[model samples]
Structures are given as structure tokens and as C-alpha cells.
Target chain A: AQSVTQPDIHITVSEGASLELRCNYSYGATPYLFWYVQSPGQGLQLLLKYFSGDTLVQGIKGFEAEFKRSQSSFNLRKPSVHWSDAAEYFCAVAADNDMRFGAGTRLTVKP
Target chain B: EAGVAQSPRYKIIEKRQSVAFWCNPISGHATLYWYQQILGQGPKLLIQFQNNGVVDDSQLPKDRFSAERLKGVDSTLKIQPAKLEDSAVYLCASSLEPSPYNEQFFGPGTRLTVL
Candidate 1:
């Protein structure tokens, strides 16, 4: 079975600071990875995805993720985060036509 | 394009009671999914539908939970004799197809509280 792991339970960052959220996956075959963000009382929104071709994928809201097959990791990065960027982030992996998601990391932006 | 739609943004019922949730997928989408999200955890898929047929439902607790996507457009999930553990947000999502590469659009979700 495919699984996704997000190590950080919560992270507090100052506004305008760089941000990186770690994600790791366990799968036997090639994995399709994705990053999603959810604000309070809102639905999950797609930030980015990686299927193949190019390890780095840019997403909406000035976010990007790099898929490193060697380490089985796909980490999301943002050069500078705004206060609005504070939300819960989820990493997902697709396998056997089903998608599995990580526990999610809650981001807090200090203004 | 319109995103997925779900009704009853909030639901509260006593334990052992029954509840149901409705979802409308985006137009022209062939794949629909239902997920349960507990507080502090990511959403976990309960069932999936592809054009009015069940694609995957291994994680669904068939003993009390039942879902149907009739006519391949709208879906409904029902929980009979609910438990306290079943209190969570039920999210509905839709995709163009039943492939791993396709992106999924989600609805606001129905927050269920079992007292």
C-alpha cells in the first residue's frame, strides 16, 4: 500500500520568511505526488502536482514543490510567505488508482 | 468552472442517529470521491465513483456507511446509527477521469458532529 508522511505537525514562521514543508512517500512503483492547502472553513485547494518529466513543479499562490525520487521526497517551498499563506498543508501520493494523503502540517504565520 | 458542491454545511445529531450527506460534482466530471477528515488529520478517502459505478470503496465501513452516485452526476452518503468517532468533515471531490494524473476539485465539506 502507498502512504504519505508529513513530519511536521506544526510550524510557526514569521511573515516574509522562507518556508519548506517536508513530505515523504512509500511506494513500490513510480509515484504521482501532489500538494494541497486548506484554509479554515474552506476546502482543500491544489497547490501543485508531479507526475513525470521535471522534478520541480510550480503551483498556484507562489508555491512550488520538488519531487526527488532518490529520497522519495516531495517538499513544498516558498521563498517568502504571506500571512494569508497560513493554513494546513497536505501531501498525497497516488497508487493503484487510489490516492493516499499524509497527516498534514499546520502552518502558522507570525505577523 | 463551478467547483464541487455539497449540502448541509453543518450537521449535528445524537449518537445512534442516522445522517446523510449530498454532493454534486462538477459538470462533465466522470470521477467522484468522498473523504472523511478528522480534526488535525488529512482527508481519508471513503469511497470513489466513476460514472455511476463504484471504482473503489475498500476503506468505507460498509456495515454502517452507504454511498451512491446515481446517474453519474450527484452522490449521497448515508450513515446509520452513527458513532462519536464518525464526527468529522465529509468532503466531496470530482475529477475529469479516474486517473492518477487528473486534478481534483473539492467542495466546502459537511461538518458532522455526533453528540
Candidate 2:
């Protein structure tokens, strides 16, 4: 079974500051990774996905994530996060045809 | 197009009561899923349906949980004699296919509080 781990439980950053959230996956084969964001009392929205092709994938809301095979990591990054980016982020890995999610990391933006 | 739709945004019931949730997946989607998310934890897949057929339901608690998709379009998840631990957010998602690589659209989810 594939599993994902999010090292950070919560991350705080000021508006306009850069942000990075770490994600690690345990899979035997080529992993299909994804990042998703969820606001308060809402369903999760897809951020980005890495299947093949480029190591870095861009998503909506100025979010991007890099898929590194050697380190088994796919970390999400934002050059300058906005106040609206404050939400819970989840990292997921595809196992067979099922997807497993991480515990998630909550992002807090300070003014 | 409209996204996935789920009914009963919030429900509060006492333990041992029964509850049900409805979900309407996006048109033409072949895969539907039900997940349970506890506070501070990620969503866990309880059951999956592929065109009205059961695909995966290994994690579902059969004794208390039951789900069905009629006509391969809409779904309903029911919990009988709900336990206190059943209090959580139940999310419904749909994808174009049974593959996980395909993008999945999520509904707003139904929050259940078992007192």
C-alpha cells in the first residue's frame, strides 16, 4: 500500500513571504503524487499533480510542487503566498487505483 | 458544469441513531467514492463505486455502514446505530474513471456530530 507523510503539522508565514510544505511518499513503483488544499468547512481542491513528464508542476493560485524521485519527496512551494492561501494542504499518493492522503499541514498567513 | 453535490451539510444526532447522506456525482463520471475525515486527520476511503458496481470497500465498517449507487449516477451512504466515533466529515468525490490519476471532484461534504 502507498502512504504519504507530511512533516509539518502547521506552518505560519506572513503575507508576501515564500512558502514550502514538505511531502514524502512510500511507494515501490513510480508514484503518482498530488497536492490538495481545503478551506474551512469546504471540500478539498486540487492544487497540482505529478505523474510523469516535468519534475515541477504548476497549479492554480500560484502554487507549485516538485517531484523528486531520489529523495521520495514532492514538496509544494509558493514564491509569495497571499492571505487567501491560508488553508489546510494535503499530500496524497496513488496506491494501485486508490489514493491515500497524508495528515495534512495547516497554513496560517499573518498580516 | 456543476461540481459534485452532497446533501445535508450538517447533521447532529445521538449515539445509536441512524443517519444517511446523499451524493450526486458529476455527469459522465464513472467512479464515485465516499471518505471519512476526522479532526486533524486526512480523509479515509470507506467505499468506492464504479458505475453502480462495487469496486473497493475494504475499509468500510460493514456492520454499521452501508452505501449504494443506484443507476450509476447518484449515491447514498447510511450509518445504522451510529457510534460516537462516527462523528466526522463525510466527503463524496467523483472522477472520470476508476484510475486514481484522473482528477477527482469533491463535494462540500456532510458533517455529522454524534452526541
Candidate 3:
């Protein structure tokens, strides 16, 4: 069973500030990783995914995540976050066809 | 392309009552999934269907929960006697295949309140 851990329960950043949300997973082998965002009253939307190839995966809304095998971490990053980036972000890991999600990190953008 | 569709955006019911949610996946998707998301938590998968066949229902509470996909296209999830703990958002998602790499499109979700 694979599990995802998002240490940050909430993150606050100013508009146009750099942001990073840490995500760590516990898996024996290389597992499929993903980042998803959910706005208020909206469903979760896929941000990016890492299966086998690239270490750094780019996603929509000017966000990206880097998969570090040695650290068992896949942290999401954004150079300059916008006001619209305020939402809940979830990290998920899948292995043996079963997927698990983290508790999620809530992002708050300050004006 | 149109995203996944779920009916009754919101519902309110008392404990021990029954509630059912309807979902219609994308036109060409072969995999449909139902997930429960409690307040302040991430979405947890309840059941997964692969073209009308049950692929996974391990996390679903079988005692009072039941789900079915009659035609492999549309699905319905029912709770015989809903509990207060069952209050949450039920989300429907679909993907082109059953693989994890396949991107899933999600529906707006149905918010259920059990008082």
C-alpha cells in the first residue's frame, strides 16, 4: 500500500511570490505520483503526473513538481503564484493499481 | 470534450435515510470511479468500475453502501441508511483506461449533508 504525506496543512504566500508544497510518499518501488488541485465547489483537477520518465514534470496554471527518487519526495513548485492559485492541493501515489491521496495542503494567497 | 456529469449538486437528509447519487462518465471513457471527500480532507476512492465490471470496491462501506453500473456508461451509488459520518462530497471521475497514468476528468460532485 502506497501513502502520500503532505506535511504542510496550510500555506500562505503573497501574490507573485514563489511557493513550494512538499509531498513525501512511502512506497517500496517507484510509484506513480500525481498532483491535483480543487477549488471551492469544484472537482479535483489533475495538475501533473510522474510515472517513469522525467524527474521534473510541468503542469497547468504555471505549476511544476520534481520527483526525487532518493528522497521519496515529489514537491510541487511555482515561481510566481497568482491570486487564483488559492485552493486545496492534494498529492496522490499509486502502486499495484491502487491509489491513495494525502490529506491535502490548502493554499491561501494574500493580496 | 464534456467532463463527467453528476446529478443533484447538493442534498440534505436526516440520519438513517436513503440517498442515491447518479453519475455519467465521459463518452469514450472506459473507467469510472466514485470518491468521497470529507471536509478538510482529500478525496478517497470508494469504488471503481471498468466498463460495468467491478474493478475495485475495497474502500466502500458495504454494510450500507451499494453501487451499480447497469450499462457500463452510467452509475448510481446508494446508501440504504445514511449515517452522519456519510456527510461529504461525492465525486465522479472518468478516464480513458484503467491505468494510473491516464488522466482522469472529474465531475463537479454532489454534496450530501446528513443531519
Candidate 4:
């Protein structure tokens, strides 16, 4: 079975600082990777996804992720974080016609 | 375009009771999915429907959970004799197709609390 791993459980970053959320997946073949953000009491919204070409994929809200096949990782990065970026981030892998999500990483932006 | 719609923003029920949630996907979407999201955890896929047929339901607890998407537009997920562990937010999402490449739009979700 395919699975996604988010090493960080919680992260606190100062406002306007750089942010990087690590994600790794275990799969045999080429994987479809995705990043989603969920605010409190709300459903998840897609941040970005990597399907094929272009090792780096840019998504909504100035977010971007780099798909590194060698390490089986797709880490989300943002140059400067904002207060509104504080939310739970989920890394997911899609395979076998199904998608599996990681435990999730909670991001907190401090001013 | 309108996103997915889920009914009963909140529900409270006793353990071993029955509960149901309704979801209306975006018009013309061919794929619909149901997910269970526990507090502090990511959403877990419970079932997936393509049109009016079941496509993937491997994680759904068939013994206590049932879901139907008749007419291929709206869906209903029912839980009989709900347990305390079933307390979580039930999310509904839809995509243009069943392929992994399609982006899924999610609803606000129905929060279920079992006492």
C-alpha cells in the first residue's frame, strides 16, 4: 500500500520567514503527489500537486513544491509566510485509484 | 462554479444511534468521494463513487456504514449504531473525473459528535 509521511508534527515560524514542510512517500512506480491546507472548522483546500514533468510545481497562495524522485519526497516551500498561512498541511499520495494522506503538520505563524 | 455541498453542518447523537449525511457535488462532476477527518488528523478516504457506482470503498466500514449516490449527482452516507470513535468531520469532495490528475473540490463538511 502507498503511504505518505510528514515528519514534522508542528512548526512555528516567525511572520515573513521562510517555510518548508517536508513530505515523503513510499511507492514503487511514479507517484502523484499533492499538498493540501485545512483551516480550523473547514474542509481542505489544495495547495499544489505534482503529476508529471516539471520537478517544481507552483500552486495557489504563493506556495510551491518540489518533487524529488530520488528521495521519494515532495516538500512544500514558501519564501515568506503570512499569518493566514497558519493551518494544518497534509501531504498525500495517489496510486491504485486511491489517495492516502499523512497525519498532517500544523503550521503556526508568529508575528 | 459552486463547490460541493454537505447538509447538516453539525450533528449530535448518542452512541449506538443512527446518523446520515448528505452531499451534493458540482454539476457534471463524475467522481464523488467521502472522507472522515478526526481531530488533529488528515482526512481519510472512506468511499469513492463514479457516477452512481461504487469505485473505491476499501476503507469504509461496511458493517456499520453505507453510502449511496443515486442519479450520480447527490450522495448520502449513513452510519448505523454509530460508535464514539465515529465522532469526526465527514467531508465530501468531487472532481471532474476519477483520475488522480483532476483537482478535487471539497465541501465545508458535516461535524458529527457521538456522546
TM-score of 4: 0.98
Q: Write the per-residue lDDT of candidate 2 for residues A1-111, one digit (tens) a residue.
A: 889999999999999999999999999987789999999988999999999999989999999999999999999999998999999999999967879999999999999
lDDT of 2 by residue, B1-115 (tens): 9999999999999999999999999999999999999999999999999999999999999999999998999999999999999999999999999886789999999999999
Model 4 lDDT tens row, A1-111: 899999999999999999999999999987899999998878889999999999999999999999999999999999999999999999999986879999999999999
Task: Give me the chain B TM-score of candidate 1.
Answer: 0.98
When superposed on Cα atoms, how far off is each prediction in RMSD? 0.8, 0.7, 0.7, 0.8
Report the C-alpha lDDT of model 3 over A25-71, residue by residue, as the tens digit. Answer: 99999999999999998999999999878799999989999999999
Q: For candidate 1, what is the DockQ-based docking class?
A: high
Model 1 interface DockQ: 0.89
Q: In model 3, which regions exceed 4 Å deviation?
A: none
The per-residue C-alpha lDDT of model 2 at residue B78 equals: 100
Off by over 4 Å in 4: none
Q: In candidate 3, what are the lDDT values of residues B44-88, reduced to their tens digit?
A: 999999999999999999999999998999999999899999999
- lDDT (Cα, 0-100) at A98 in candidate 1: 80
In candidate 2, how many Å is residue B92 off? 0.2
Give the clashing pairs for model 3.
none
TM-score of 1: 0.98
- Model 4 Cα shift for residue B106 (angstroms): 0.6
Check candidate 2 and list the clashing pairs: none
Error of 3 at B96 (Å): 0.9
